[model samples]
Target: MKSLVALAVGALVAGGIAFAAPASAGCQAGWTPWGGGEICDGPVGSDGNFERCQTTGVLGFGGTQCFIANVGNAQPPRVGP
Candidate 1:
């Protein structure tokens, strides 16, 4: 029995990945804009000057590019799981 337990433990350790589960959560949609973000009214819009977080995404002069879930709340980014 001890040998079986030891073998199982050894195999798990060797696999490395079994140590812990992957962290949940990622850049949520309409949560916040990232990269160059998106433009709502037009593509050439500027930050704050032209765009604002909306349900569809950072709206501006053209249209939205980023997902809506990534650009809504005014709260700072947080870890989600």
Candidate 2:
């Protein structure tokens, strides 16, 4: 019984560690860390600049989504033409 309990505890601890690992792991190359997720600059488009976001839940078991958005161009407006 004691061995069984120890085994269960060990499993739980291992699982917890695995689940928490990604939260601290560095983002992939070119990606930057964001609030509990990672993001990176996306390709510029005719409309504007873009940013991509990727989110994942613990152990990637659920609540994973990816999206891109336009953040507008960064150039200042011309004056005194």
Candidate 3:
């Protein structure tokens, strides 16, 4: 029973999805802020997860918007579902 409980907890942790700054913006998906607004280049398909605001890290409230690029470089190619 203890092992089953542990397994359940592990599954729960694994099943949950982590939303990063870039991920929330849908920019890089995992890209995060190193601070000072340094130029960032990520691998293709790489996701950015920036964490600047202390409040809820979603779009509109200054969280990474999934529809806009945080940086001023060319946007990434849109991926098809």
Which model scores highest in lDDT? 2
In terms of lDDT, model 3 sits at: 0.29
Higher-ranked by TM-score: 1 or 3 = 3
In TM-score terms, candidate 2 sits at 0.31
lDDT, candidate 1, 17-71, per-residue tens: 2232323333223222321221122122234222223122122212234323222
- What is the per-residue lDDT of model 2 for residues 6-48, given as tens digits with 9 covering 90 to 100? 4544444334433342333222211112212332344556776
Question: Which model scores highest in TM-score?
Answer: 2
- Scanning candidate 2 in windows of ten residues, the lowest lDDT window is 72-81
lDDT of each: 0.29, 0.35, 0.29
Candidate 2 colliding pairs: none
- Model 1 poorest 10 in a row by lDDT: 34-43
Measured on C-alpha atoms, candidate 1 has an lDDT of 0.29
> Stretches of candidate 1 above 4 Å error?
17-81
Q: Give lDDT: candidate 1, residue 24.
A: 31
Off by over 4 Å in 3: 18-81
Ranking of models by TM-score: 2, 3, 1
